[model samples]
Target: MSAALKIGFENPVAQSQAVFRAVMMALARPGTVRRLDVPVDAVPALDPAAAAVALALCDYETPVWLDPALAADLQVQEFLRFHTGAPVTEARALASFAFVPLGGEVPALDDFAQGSLDYPDRSTTLVVAVEALAEGEGWRLTGPGVAGEGRFIARPLPADMLDRLQRNHALFPRGVDLVLTCGDRFAAIPRSTQVDA
Candidate 1:
């Protein structure tokens, strides 16, 4: 089989379900890292966790936008299209999910859809590939899911990540959400969470 056709959940139904749970739990407990139960073979310019997110959460109804690095890779595009049936969109604001490969340039928070006052769920969800996910000195998180505070440390983050996150959080119900991925591990920081450097 071609490489593009080779990447997807080993057991479509069961594995996707597991990945879905892991994703939800990551979001439910902001700043907490979760590892995917099943392995997702890496695509040309995509991380395993990012691939898992696309396979498990995206479909024909969900349009995805790929960063420059990922968009330049035909095999990565074909793999996502073949497995998820999600159309690749050029307009960032119109995408339901945006995938950014490691070292890829991330657009400004306002570049993506921020939903609206009446329907906040319409906002975009960013799946960003990072160098690593670790504990210890990093951005401090609080609010909603966090008890008192939570630590989120991912390398190669945008210099103004905390500022951007603060602005996103201020948007409350109408802001983009982020999922940071590395290898097979992932973590989330919803719009409801507050970030402090």
Candidate 2:
């Protein structure tokens, strides 16, 4: 079969539910790495975890924005649209969810919607495919989900990632949340988390 027609979750409902739970748990425990073992046929330009995020969270109502490389891949577009029914958007600010590659050029956090004060939850969820995901090292994280503090790391992210994260955190109740994925593992850094750069 063509890459564009690649299968999504082997068991749609069950797999999506499992992936969703993993993603939520990661977010709720900020800096915690969760494994997404959902079986999915590879889609061009997207890591398995990234595709899992889309399948579990995206729907017809959510508009998605992909970085240049991902956006340019027609097969990736078809696979996502077919399985998730998410619209591909060109305007970053209009995106409900945006995907970027850590090893490639990534847009500034501000580029995506920072929802209004009255509707901060409307902000975009940034899903970044990174080179690595690990715990107990790198940036020190603290805030809500964290008990005392947590350490998280992702490789090949921009050199100014910490600065960008600090700025996003400063936005408080109105900034985009982030999910970093590598291979079949993923982790989150919600805007509420403070990064000790």
Encode model 2's per-residue lDDT on 173-196: one tens digit a residue: 999999999988999999999999
Query: Please, what is the TM-score per model?
Result: 0.96, 0.96
Q: Pick the candidate with the highest lDDT.
A: 2
lDDT of each: 0.89, 0.90
lDDT of 1 by residue, 127-149 (tens): 99898987545889999889889
Global lDDT of model 1: 0.89
Residue pair clashes in candidate 2 = none
